[model samples]
Target: MHAEPACETSLSTPPSARWPVVPLQPAVREAAPRQPATRCSTCSLRAVCMPADLTSTELQQLDTVVLTTRNVHRGETLFRAHDAFQSLYAVRTGSFKTVVMHRDGREQVTGFQIPGEPLGLDGVCSGTHSCDAIALEDSTVCIMPFGQLETFCRESRRMQRHLYQLMSGEIVRESSLVMLLGTMTAEQRLAAFLLDLAARFQARGYSGAQFNLKMSREEIGCFLGMKLETVSRMFSRFQREGLVEPNGKQIRIVDLEGLARV
Candidate 1:
């Protein structure tokens, strides 16, 4: 059996004069809705997302705070660096990548968010988004307006604790990434990355051993601190060693222990 990760992991933002906000184009605003938006109590992702201990009335309160779902298309920018931040986004479907531009003009992949994941926490401390969140595919996110969320959190200890846990998890995940890049060999890093993804998918009730890669090899390499060529070579090596089987962007872990050993 594969070791489970504590929670989903990822890969933030900048400080400056807040950028002039541009309204999302009408066409972009209306991507075909995947499903009719539902209340928080009825949301399928509530188990992994909201506090598990909330009472029925508290769940109803949360539902009122969430305004609606917003659809983001492949390659669309959900929020850009320096944009004034007001809401936190919960991934209702698909995935997103958070990236920051370096002073040297290169972009760094900060994190990848799957379903049930939240983005825009970077803004809490600064009041402006420090990174850009871009959708990897057609996706939808529930909008949790921070002001309302903060009010609700104050009245419920469980919800407050859950919010702290999410923030704390983000901090720990970042520290782990630093350690991962600082100490681990390329192979170990790749193995850990795949295993992390597997655990997250399994948590979402998907097959942990098999899944599609929403982020490309280039993006994965950027996030994992390796070259694209190196990422590809590692994939080939893992395939040859029977650690995993790759068909295009889809991968299956044939030997979970073998991967864990790396």
Candidate 2:
């Protein structure tokens, strides 16, 4: 989520006058791929992904549990449904969408995950993944081996509490989605979805008013239990009413109060 600062070197001076040129050397072979950083204590997302109030010693111990990271490309499945689940993944960068396929072959998007979110919780109880987690963009995830995590959790009360909270959060999210699907209108569902995204982004140190949609309208519709056309219409209506402004996949909430009232 950190943006590379723009290089702002002045070009007023000629290159020859600004610095001395060195003679070219023999060309070297391509370097090996760089490994991602695995230290949780130094990670920018530790606050969001790890348990709070963890001492330096605790963080170092936790780092031992998360020993590696895996990169998943856009549109690629991180893990398919029914895969034997061995580890939980914490999003280090980018986002993902979890999908469940019906017997009729229709795919339903269950949830969208941003950076710092956890995936693979669906398999905690059954020991087999119940859905597919697909990367929405080229992303990296810290792999926490569940066995080691469980052992560590037993030793650290804080970690055990945090693990329980994560499971509770998953239950609450699913229940809320059920309520939305069963009791809410399409407009209300979409409004709540947008508001929820805004709040999540704000919690992650991003702007609440403006952000790009990582999931497509069709994906959103699937998650919201609405048709693609209905999802598009809702966005158009929100724009027309001056509650939001949409340009392609980008959205800006122009009137937070108005959107809340929807």
Best-matching candidate per TM-score: 1
C-alpha lDDT of residue 37 in model 2: 60
> Which window of ten consecutive residues has the lowest lDDT sum in model 2?
1-10
Worst 10 residues of 1 by lDDT: 6-15
Q: Show model 1 residue runs off by greater than 4 Å.
A: 1-36
Model 2 regions more than 4 Å off: 1-36
Would you give me the overall lDDT of model 1? 0.82
Tens-digit lDDT string for candidate 1 (157-208): 9999999999999989888887776677788888999999999999988999
Clashes of 1: 5
- Candidate 2 lDDT by residue in tens digits, 70-105: 888899888877677788899999999998765556
TM-score of each: 0.87, 0.86
